[model samples]
Target: MEVWLNYVFGLRPRNFWGLVCIPLFPLLHGSYQHLTGNTQAFLLLGWFILMQGIHLFYVVTIATALISGVGAWLFGPPNSVGVGASGVIYGYLGFILMYGIVSGSWIALLLTLIIAVRDAWRITGNKYNESQLLPVERSPRMGWTAHLFGFIGGVLIALALSDMRLN
Candidate 1:
């Protein structure tokens, strides 16, 4: 089931058939660990966005998934399949941080600060040590491209939404 789902839904870079995965990849995971890790962050960040507004939460999620997925599909390492919600989690983190700054919400700002302090390593792209890996062993590669694009997308979305409010 896992293999089948990944084959069908995982983002594959530069593959014409993989375009559908843009909106679906965030819903798939490579393993239990992947799913669990994403679940915690997704729920927490999603809750923060939800606290602002349910509509905003949905909009951010959809936009982030599309932007991040397209980024991964375009720039992911050749022959690699990207599967997991880490990209979306990163998107949520970006959205919360930027939204807080743009909206000047004290609660959002406080929460962002807490998350930043706690997940600084992750946000800064130092969460893994590739040098420690055995050359013979296979490990999932971090989707840094997705994370980068997702964060950018989140910030852009936050700015757009804030502008809409101002007008």
Candidate 2:
């Protein structure tokens, strides 16, 4: 059902309508396998974001989704449908990473570094890394475009919001 919803609402690369699907994209998944892959990042990152504050969490989530969707829609492979929360997870990762540097939060920086090393290690050894890296462009495969865009989005949002009293 969610998958079907994804087909109906997922972001279409280079399509203007994709903007409408930005917020919705995070709510849909390509498959159970895809959903499962994203679940841990979503929960863990989401928890950490919430730890900052409910409002910050909401702001980061929505901003990342919108920015990620725009990025995928504008720069992703044409005529393709992209859906998943991995982008948002990437956004969370980016937010934490940038938050540490911008706000001088050592804990956030350390956590982001640890995650990056772990994921980088997995990609280096895993035969499936290529597929995961360009998943959306490859068709019926895991793509990292959303993740990249989401991370960028998160960084942008964090930069914009870090000055606020977001404690």
Candidate 3:
């Protein structure tokens, strides 16, 4: 329902939710620490996508979640509740990085590389990237697998999620 708001604005649904609110869909934190960290990374990444003004982001988001949910169900620990936007976030990262590589654009490639490097540094257990705009404190509880899978899913499902063709 909210997705249709993008059509009114002539943008992609995936871009809107994918970059902004969708990440929150999967992993909503209960503690201030949890929410703060996610919110910070989300805001920074969000600013990047917002500049692109693509609105049909919901498709990418929905697909990523569906795929990641399946991935989590298939591979995640038994009986564990999977909730967090990390999966979709990673999916976005995968999509952007792959897009840059496939398109051969230096800017896209460079940005993707930056994001990759940062995310990698963030992923290391018991370490945090000091330069990160998001929270510097690391949570050992975060799920790296979901992030990895989600990023892969984002690339895998980008086209299926997109509302319009570039051509």
Candidate 4:
């Protein structure tokens, strides 16, 4: 099943159309666990991004997808097909974290800080490590590389928009 899916829909390194999978793969999930994890992160971070404004939301979303997708296609494992929304969520996380820093908004900074602390605590205090602070690449199936690249993508976009005085 995994082999079949990777061949067809997974993001393969150096594959041109697989580049399309960069944006599209985030919309796919390998299992219920994968879907729920991405959903929670997306909803929370997405809310904050949405608060910035609807137009910015669309802008950031598209930017994250393209940047994150391209990064994965260029640097991801040769034989693997990356999938899941962790990249986008990580992008959102990066945007929030950097936007606060760039804008010098105390409220945004505090909000980002709180989330950081909370995630750290969750990872440290949990008995089973149920929650993670950063997206950790635990399985060959989990695309943590995309998460990382997506985060970098978000930070870059936020930096680019910092001078616009969006805050």
Clashing residue pair totals per candidate (backbone < 3 A): 0, 3, 18, 0
25-107: candidate 2 lDDT, tens digit per residue: 87788778778877977888789889899989999988888877788777777677888887788888788777877776667
lDDT of 4: 0.73
The TM-score of predicted model 3 comes to 0.62
How many residue pairs in model 4 have overlapping backbones?
Answer: 0
Tens digits of per-residue lDDT for model 3, 108-165: 6788798887766544434343221133224433444466567678676544433422
Model 2 RMSD vs true structure: 3.0
- List model 1 lDDT by residue over 1-114, tens digit each: 997999887888899777777777888887797788789888888987887778888999999888888887887778877887777777887887787788776776777789
Model 4, residue 83: distance off in Å is 0.9
TM-score of each: 0.86, 0.82, 0.62, 0.83
Worst 10 residues of 4 by lDDT: 122-131
Rank candidates by lDDT, best first. Answer: 1, 2, 4, 3
Error of 3 at 64 (Å): 1.9
Tens-place lDDT digits, model 4, residues 1-167: 75466467777778887976665787777778778977987888888889889988888888887777787788777877777776677788788788878888788889879877755543232554333324555444545566667788889988998964444
User: Which candidate do you rate higher for TM-score, 1 or 3?
Assistant: 1
CA shift at 102, candidate 3, in angstroms? 1.3
- Model 3: number of clashes? 18
Please give the ranking of all candidate structures by TM-score, highest first, separated by commas: 1, 4, 2, 3
In angstroms, how far off is 71's CA in candidate 1? Answer: 0.8
